[model samples]
Target: MKKPQKAIVTFTNPTVKERLKPHLYSMMIKPWRMIKNTLMLTGAFVWLLLLLVCLYFYSVLSKVPDLEKVPFQHVREVAVESVQSKIESKTKLKEYQWVGIDNVNRDLLYAIVMSEDGQFFSHKGVNWDALISAIGENIKRRELSYGASTISQQVSKNVYMRSNSKSFSRKLSELFTTRELEKHLSKNEILELYLNVAEFGPDIYGVKHASKYYFGKSPADINAAEGAFLAIMLPSPRKYHYSIFQNKHLAPRHQRKLRRIFSDMLYKEYISPNQYQSYLKWNYFFN
Candidate 1:
């Protein structure tokens, strides 16, 4: 009976901190955990994007052959828009020939460089100024009127793209391939390859074939006027070739364009005064 009476319990109130500690700690660290996870995700995404770009670059450049070792071809085939185009057009391919740099005259090279890209020798691949200007021009025109693609870019486009389709992906690939070309090949080599692959007429491809088809001479033997004519033909080869080959004379507008190219060549000191005079007076003719 005495032991039962002595049995008693004491009670104490708990503090606010002790009651709320676990919830408060979790609230404090929630934002930090979210931030850490977000950062990790962003980093992984960037790495994946870089890996895709590197793989694309390699894929674009892998198909190109070194001119110093193997000859490159301009694979030409006019896709006739017909139900039986493929079956009927078994041999729609045009002419293409690989010409070495040493076999081509320096004047022709200079003329092309002057007409296509004035800063061809200095710039690596892209010309920002001309490109910006072209972008502005195209925006104003509300059409893709201008392309400031360097000779290197043209080479990349002609070789890889195969068609004149101006898709955004094609342009991006051209940029990547142009840089790769600069890294792998010399300037002269790039020019040589371009001269060989560029479209000169509806059916003409490469300077070697172009020289013989248009002028009845080799590229090395082409004069300043002929070189300038060839340079101007680049923008619209089929459109420009309104000639005896196509059973029509050269358009007056094309002649004017050719003269303008000549003027540019002279102003840039790519040709002498006598050459300029000769370029102005010479008849724009092809064999």
Candidate 2:
């Protein structure tokens, strides 16, 4: 009789098993869920990083103010820095002036256009052909030596960025700033600002100051020979400045650069065949 009573065992509830089914399924999928969550998080992080990079480039570009109508107080700020440096070093400060493009010598303009950026008028902010060529040359030379910096790019570096860094980040900043500058200013305006702010010698700033100091004449009064000489001196102002004083003539390198300028000018039809011949014949010391 006891063995027959033991045969009546309690059965599990079907509703309870149904309630536990979801929990069991979730446990089975736990690793896949973790993997999916991790992938989602990684994607979000990558998107966020891309957004930050774009924002950084935009911020750098936005710093270049609209120069269409604004008076270049930025030049004065840079001049003040130079003046402070001179005071700290106990050196006599050189003169700096903001001159209009009209006030500068035509020959000087031509020379700079030829020597520095032949396609200055046509290019937006970069010369892709020259840049590509420079890149090829650098690769061949196995050195980061070749430079294809346009006038606009130079202005961006001089005004917004430090000149000491030769990093990829610095170049990227320069490129962004140059695009901003081109968007805000005309080609002639860019040229005018560059002429006003470009460094000439140890303390000499601007073509106006350089012209007055070296030739004892205003930029407006300088001749082709003097203009070419000043333009040539731009590459190494301090060295050429002393050399001009000691030698009383242009160095061989300067002469070679002038010839290159003349050739460019002639090719661009900025000068006539007769003018090119005349320039070739003209000596830096004789005139």
Candidate 3:
């Protein structure tokens, strides 16, 4: 019988090898693809965790009560010490006094409204015109400039939350807290809260305390000139107060600015011209 024919194999054509090479390469890389997928999932989880943390803080800020409802004993003690430390370092001053809201002069409110937020009563939480103007000015000046934060917004910041550096995240948090505050409190209530908690000087926190520290009187007794002076100090109370008392040259300029702001209030029909002129001529003796 004839021997069985030996089995024979043929080589694949070049075209087939090329096509199969890709499939084989993909199979070889399957382990690496799994690792890559795992890493991507881990990254996504970390990002989600950060988002949850931010949301948690935002919720906490929104629910925080007004300054009166907050436990003053917890915050007031710390705030006093913090402010005192700043004053001692900056001005070498030691004396500090705390006064209540009822003792503050009402006239001072008008001055603050005129100087800080001209449209306090009319506008909502944000001042669009002032915000636009501030944005334009900052862009033109190419530097960080003043913003148009409303009294309500300031109250939210000072009482419920700390001031944040300018960033999208911080701004979103501010807006959330501000909206919550607006919903819970009336405009007048917000203003009252602000007056009760605002920092007037290094260690002087609140209108009542500032009144006694500066003018040796209650906030209710502060005259228009005194109100304007205090309003001027709002921008940089520590710096301006020192300048007014220590640097003779700066005192005149600060006085002039205060006069201009007081006059502007009259021009805007917020106060009487007689009142404006009276304050212009009134003598202010800083203590």
Which one is best on TM-score? 2
Candidate 1 runs further than 4 Å off: 1-95, 243-252, 285-287
Q: Which candidate is the best by lDDT?
A: 2
Worst 10 residues of 2 by lDDT: 83-92
Give the higher-lDDT candidate: 1 or 2: 2
Q: Would you list the clashing residue pairs of candidate 3? A: 104-219, 104-220, 105-219, 105-220
lDDT tens digits, residue span 1-93, model 2? 555555668898679889899999998899899999999999999999999999987776666555566555665465346433433223334
Q: lDDT for model 2, on a 0 to 1 scale?
A: 0.76
lDDT of 3: 0.69
The Cα error of candidate 1 at residue 191, in Å, is 0.4
TM-score of candidate 1 on Cα atoms, chains taken together: 0.66
Q: Write the per-residue lDDT of candidate 3 for residues 102-189, one digit (tens) a residue.
A: 5655567778877778788887778888878988998899875767788877776665555457754565566666776676556766
Error of 3 at 72 (Å): 12
Rank list by lDDT:
2, 1, 3
Better of 1 and 3 by lDDT: 1
Q: Looking at candidate 1, what is the lDDT of residue 82?
A: 16
